[model samples]
Target: MSLSKDKGEQNPLEKALAAYIEALQTKPVLTKAVTSGCISAIGSLVSQLIVPNPANGGKIVWRSVAAYAAFGFVVSGPLIHKFYILLDKMMPPKKEKTALDGIKRVVVDRLVFAPPFLLLFLYVITILEGQGHQAAIARIRESFFPVLKLNLQVWTVFQYVNVNYVPPKYRVLFGNALALIWSVFVASKRRKMALANK
Candidate 1:
């Protein structure tokens, strides 16, 4: 009788446990994570493409598309997601998430965020350049302030657009577009710099 009664009663938590199990099986959390990842990568490549154009002399077009794509997928995508996720968690939007909240985001992002990403980006470019002869640092060192000013302008402007208008949901796509522009400039500059050096 007790055994039958126990079966009839069951447990409320059993339903919850079952629901949780079902949720895991479907893995919506994982899907969301992946979506975030894709967004980040795509966005970054686009942004990277644009900001490097100051180096371009004449040849600036769609030639750097592949590089921008790869950059987006590999470097920019993963890093952007990490930044966005961390920032979201550390300082999640309480209400509607005002733009003024950018102050906190900027503090965590630029100080803790921008430098590392920028360093890694520079490092990657440096390595790629070194592999051939386009070493980014060497080229930049060949002309310091000009490169500095050019980079400052592009990054600052691009970032402002990204932070102000773009919702975090779309930052990745935004970044990709910006990267594409940077790539054009970068490719053009690289070509010109190479030719001039010769």
Candidate 2:
């Protein structure tokens, strides 16, 4: 009966999903930003669910979720996408001689971008939650090293494969997919810290 789609044709859901992925491929920055916000919001929701909260009838901390999602959409996603583009432009990825180039990309990414990004994420979350400047500084001071250590351990190895194997256009997508787990980890830590402080 259907001329456009045969019986064996993709279902509507699959077609919609395929179209969405294709759109993401076309617009890397916006797609990644939207993905970041969604993943971060999911992470925050999970964190609140898992972390113990006896106060406020245990409802989800919608404010934290909103703040993190907003930051991820506005800052982390676009910034990292642009950062990876710049890195690739500066140090073109080599297909054959990947060992050295991969190492260089990893080093530069970890040293230059990771530190500042982590700091900014923590500070932004703290500030958005209306924490004072002094409290924000204290939160950064308390959390920075631990988060950085985890970041180094995780991203160093991950970026090696990413830089060497992944194509430039898909790099941000790859990174953001992996960042979903990292989002949960960071959100959990933030929840713990907030509870401790309270």
Candidate 3:
């Protein structure tokens, strides 16, 4: 009886996972957008916690969080989803996947996709935060290369695993999972730069 009960019972995590999978199938873009937005907001919140803002007496900046969330939902999620599709289309997977195929995808992702995307992120976030174009350019000048260096170092290994192992449908979700940490770093860096400029 206990064994049967245990088998029938589903934990919240399991139920949520099931729902997410279903949503992905039914509404791929929306699901990814919402998921990415939530993760981005969480990352921003975590950043605020870790590097409390002296400007606001360490209180959580809900506006900043909203900006991050909006960027994820409106930009990152859809763009990433399409980008992965493009990558796969460019280098269609083989019946027998090879190391070379994965390497090519990663190279293109890091070189072609990442740099422009990072610049866009900086620019968009600044705009979303109500900072003007000049601020965006300044932010880019200050952080672009350093952030790109770190991004390549970290995402190269992760992208290899993602492109090689993860299914095309789930690739954006997998990348978003990893992007949680990246988001935190970006949020923190953005905040730090803003403060420094002031």
Candidate 4:
């Protein structure tokens, strides 16, 4: 049993996972921020690869990747970690939480949290890209409602599962995993809009 346990610990994948879990427990906010930043950077890279920008002669924009990563690290991850904690406090789980509890959590998340977050995301990205206040306003005017509509369609379901099923500690990680794809979509949309505006 000792030999087998040692071998299991020696497995690199398992070791890495264990370390990540430890980090999550020991430093939840920082760990989530780093994870979100890395994932966001990768998502930006994937978007660039999938839809090469003609403006930069089809070159990858390193700055944009950095901006996305910064947004994830500074804004998304920490906020989400706290938000999940807040949600749990707002709807403290009983031994037998009803479906209504989950529904209310989802409703609050979708209606209260998402709209301002989306707006902030659009506004921040534009500013990070060196665009002016007017440009950020224009981006919001052009993109907010359409993006919010899609966000409702997609995230309502995701939030239900997240709030109801996922553990609070893992909630940000769960959301960040899905947000990888979301980041790609947002990046592509932002790029398209930038080109359109220019």
lDDT of each: 0.55, 0.81, 0.86, 0.86
Better of 2 and 3 by lDDT: 3
State each candidate's clash count. Answer: 34, 0, 0, 0
- Taking all chains together, each candidate's TM-score versus the true structure is 0.49, 0.82, 0.86, 0.88
lDDT at residue 187 of model 4 (Cα atoms): 67
Model 1: lDDT equals 0.55
Give the clash total for candidate 1: 34
Candidate 4 local accuracy as lDDT?
0.86
Query: Candidate 4: minimum summed lDDT over ten consecutive residues — where?
Result: 1-10
lDDT of 1 by residue, 78-196 (tens): 56856776777887755566766765665565556665566565556445434434566564455545644565566765665565556665666566556555656675666677669
Tens digit of per-residue lDDT, candidate 2, span 98-145: 567678988998998999999999999888777768888999999999
Compute the lDDT of residue 157 as modeled in candidate 3: 97
Global local distance difference test of model 3? 0.86
**Residue 77 in candidate 2, Cα distance off native in Å:** 0.8
**Model 3, runs deviating above 4 Å:** 1-9, 183-198
Over 123-171, each residue of candidate 4 has an lDDT whose tens digit, in order, gives: 9988887887999999999999998999999889998999888888788
Top of the candidates by TM-score: 4
Where in model 4 is the C-alpha error above 4 Å? Answer: 1-8, 183-198
A best-first ranking of the candidates according to their TM-score comes to: 4, 3, 2, 1
Q: Alpha-carbon error at 42 in model 1, in Å?
A: 12
Q: Model 3, residue 87: what's the lDDT?
A: 88
